[model samples]
Target: MHLSIPPGNMKGTMEGEASPELKLEGDIPARYVMPQQDRPSAAAGVAPIPVVDLGRLSRPDADGGAVEEEAKLRWALETWGFFMITNHGIEASLMDAMMNASKEFFGQPTEEKQKYNNIIDGKRFRLEGYRSELLQSEGQTLDWSCRLSLQVEPEGERSFHLWPKYPKSLRDVLLQYASRTKIIKDCIMRALANLLELDEDYFINRTTTRARALARLGYYPPCPRPDLVLGFKPHYDGGALSILFIEENVGGLQVLRNGKWYNVLAKPCTLLINIAECIEIMSNGIFKSPPHRVLTNAEKERTSVAIFYGVDVETVVEPAPGLLDEKRLARFKKIKAEDYYGTVFEHFRQGKRLIDTLII
Candidate 1:
């Protein structure tokens, strides 16, 4: 499928001259600004998201350790739809290099960065390049961030032209990170499948080589009035799962739970893993796709990298047969990944979410 933006509607132009640095002098355009009630709160104390250790789960133990780990995984998925993974096997140095490379790339002059503008070859959903806003409508709220998004898996399909050339070490480091994370994703998918009493490779096998694995590097510039703008809007991911790496010093990510918004604390060398809409459907509503948003900070800039994994576009997604019983019938109808994504893109343009459209 193809998605494009007209030349005249490019980002940062209407508000003023397009530049790398954020324009902090004028009032935020009405469309870019959100209502006061929608602004994030400065609550002093908030509960922290759960953190799970993969290394511990992998080590052999006689105390029914594996069972305990699986239980924890199920609880976190059912309760938070998100969790932070520690000792996930990715090297700390490599993670640092990836973060530094992202910062270096976005730190380049606006002219140089624009060379990799998201609308690759003018109009195609190639899934690799840079973009300030994914949904660019006439009055849609724009995110206060710049993003570099690219597909990193099934290596053969990579578009080297869309990859950045500067920061010499970027391509190498990102490839290394993606390779390692793919392993983690596979391991987690196996555990999730077993948790539902399905074959260990149920998820891994369905995610064909053509499945899209995208990495998004986000840079949120400090805002003059943080309360007036959003770094990102409230939305659920359209993919199967996402692993996020955030700058330890800057905080802005928040997830909605029990009708309250709670801040997601940035922990050093830890990856935050969250379930997405596809997983929710595959799990037959046993797992949730939570709504999350990023708030802007007045003094601190925030940067994050998210790796989104999904099945092939034409693959049919639905509640697994093993997960259904007399009392627990399928809660979601079967649908192709492409159809689901199309619905998501449509709802996104209207400032809505596709989660509500998946109910059986």
Candidate 2:
């Protein structure tokens, strides 16, 4: 696998107004096809991503076990940048309910799901509801999936009208699930700060004021020619971190490591955690943000619920001074969080890493 960054296409070049689900036949569309040289490969027998027991490090009566677990967490961040965590304190039942809510919403009739369409006036794209990624260029290869996105943080700024109403239980279940994830997010942030020997509130403080989070529910339908299309393109996330609830027994997510792609097998009851771009900058390159993507399934449909967490959009994101010293200098330039948010979709569409531009 390789990472490339090219200037992306602009709006008004898409082939259609509605998502491709309306056009699904057994055959893949020409626009959805990738170059033959860039098709996906099977993982075969490679090892899956790491799994960590996060609860050990957060135990109130933490002992030597905490010290050991902390080291594991640090290594995972510095090397893998992705891991599945168990015992982080969120309830299993709530997780199940959240997954069900996403399925319920996407399973609705087209007219019903259209009530909260992310495209307003059939032109502008809003991040608050059901939609597919915009094709900034006519030749852009499309993903084989649709999604529902909702702002789950900065509660005051959320657009409630875009929130779904058909499921009836969706709104309430999503709220509870978001609240619980916030607690886990804070805990991990504090853990990172403590590991770096900085103030425990270093990360949490930035997020408390203007931080933003979005819950993206992805629905990847079965494809006839799975090799011809991708469920998601290859790119690392552009936020601080992301927590994911992927459907077990269905395989799709894959992470790139050592120039080879490895399938991320799902565990029955673990929540996957991915360290993103901003966190790598904050760690002064001590932590890595791995590039990952999803594969289209030939027989089974895949669904996942993920919440992406980021610092305040207006704040300038840079490495912590404490992480720098006379021996080590900054490796990246300071960039406004809002800038990444603004250009992220275009970057993803073009198979580029926005953070690569910030590398010093």
Candidate 3:
């Protein structure tokens, strides 16, 4: 309820002044120009989106428990649809003070960063908006970069009643890093229901049942023309799982498949695990939801945060009656998580084609 953006919508359309301090290099210029739908054409290779590490799942030394973290969290989510968490214990100075409070709230002054402007039922959180080339069709471009989206969740009522206001020492270091990222998102959903073998209190009581975390933060900036523009376009993560945290030697994140774009090689304190589409429809789809993107930089500037972790807009997500009783077929069809979030944002506001209209 504490919003404040005046100063005449703090002018923007790139005038002059400001826009400095960005110097992390290795071959800058947004890493070799790119933007033909984030050009991937090498048959998008690199294992869909796998990474898993979570400090080799080892919970038990305080007195020996949970059998070697349930066999390395079930062989790293059955061979990764993405993973790389570490120790499942967060606090690298609360992820460097939540990445230095997301570059000090996107470097303030855009009218005090649009006084936490998020609209939700009206949808208006733009934060540097730009993505309308007939919505880039297959490339659906529009991600030079700049975010802040918040919405902690029901656990002691997280944040985001409107926008970004966490400044009480960055909201007590992001609520103690969201109370240790809600106990590592309930031990990664009870290690994804014991890696599909189910019955671990069936995902440890669905990790606080009606859950619904959120947190974006991103930044990118520095595209003076990094190959004509684009540092986030591809797509494929409507939400049901996500963690991210990025930045350990600066590397443009990527993840597409059978079409090319694999560079997600970060590794400092770790955390990336994706697997979305409501956890690929509560795991019945056998964990997939790949397709990711983010690649810009004329020289430097690329902060991340992500968070996601879903299951609450009136939760429904079907298909697990014992994986539809020996595959009698029902891969995913009980819908209503608000109509799969209104069909992935009404197909991103009818720019068209986001598919996946619940096909169980």
Candidate 4:
């Protein structure tokens, strides 16, 4: 199903009345300024989240690495629900090509970029092509970033019209990127099933069959008032999982764990995986989905490619039957995948948790 951007989310909030483009200049406009209490501070400054080696995890059990790797995956999932992977097998040339395509697309003239405007038929607002954050209130503070979002999976569902063609290699490069990540997604899903003692393909069929994959390429330019604005607000992802490639040298991503926020730093060769609310529900609270946000850079611009994956809009979402027993009960109520998406998008705009209303 095509999930339209909610009523108040699009329209005149960022770009002039037509689309959600964020036109930034000298000092940021008043609407983009965040409340003082929400400003960013110095990062926690250490190795914040665990870094998992995918190569070891993919090894044969007899090699003495898979066992230990599985244990580490369990720890990362249970604790932070976020981690970076090394030796993930996506070639450096392909990774570089993807980022370069993103840079070239965003570097185009505004009018050139508008050809893929996300607003459809000048009425409904959607999440493909060029877009900005959703506004829950009329005068809501804005995120400091702009993005190009496109649906990539279930080939039949893809809107090729929304995909950029200016970069020449953009379409092919993204297709290859998505293809490679699909393999990793399968590998991890089986590992998760193994950890839970369910069939190794348990998560595979539930998510991959008709899943929707959205590739969001984000651009966060250097902000004049980095302390007064935010690149993104704190919210848990609504999908099952997300694999991200950020501008490696620049620091902007952070995750909230316990009572504080920690930096999620990584190199160009590594990609970060974040568990989302759906996974938390599917795992019956065994896995965590931490709230994360991006801070604007003061001296340089930052960019990221985040692909969100989830069950088809028609699937049913709830704790797995195998996960529920006499001692452990369902912590979340059952909801259709479409309604789950609606609720999650609304909660994101309102800056709240979907689980708060879902908990039993």
lDDT of 3 by residue, 165-281 (tens): 645465566657866777777777766766677775554454364666767777776654555556666667775677788887776777755555676776778788777777677
Give the TM-scores of the predictions, in the order they appear: 0.89, 0.90, 0.31, 0.90
Query: Which one wins on lDDT?
Result: 4
Writing each residue's lDDT as its tens digit, candidate 2 over 37-84 gives 667976434445667777777774535777877888888888888888
Better lDDT candidate (2, 3): 2
Misplaced by over 4 Å in model 3 are 1-16, 19-109, 112-114, 117-143, 160-195, 209-212, 217-240, 243-253, 256-273, 276-292, 296-307, 310-360
Screening candidate 4 with a backbone cut-off below 3 angstroms (N, C-alpha, C), the clashing residue pairs are none
Stretches > 4 Å off in candidate 2: 1-26, 44-47, 60-63
> How many angstroms is residue 182 displaced in model 3 relative to the true structure, after the best TM-score fit?
14
**Global Cα lDDT for candidate 3:** 0.59
Higher-lDDT candidate among 1 and 2? 2
Q: Between prediction 1 and prediction 4, which has the larger lDDT?
A: 4
> Predicted candidate 3: what Cα RMSD to the true structure?
19.5
Clashing pairs in 2: none
- Model 4 misplacement above 4 A: 1-26, 121-123, 134-136
Residue 123, model 1: lDDT of 52
- From the highest lDDT down, the ranking of the candidates is 4, 2, 1, 3
lDDT per residue as tens, model 1, 298-353: 67777788999988787789899898889888887888888877677778667676
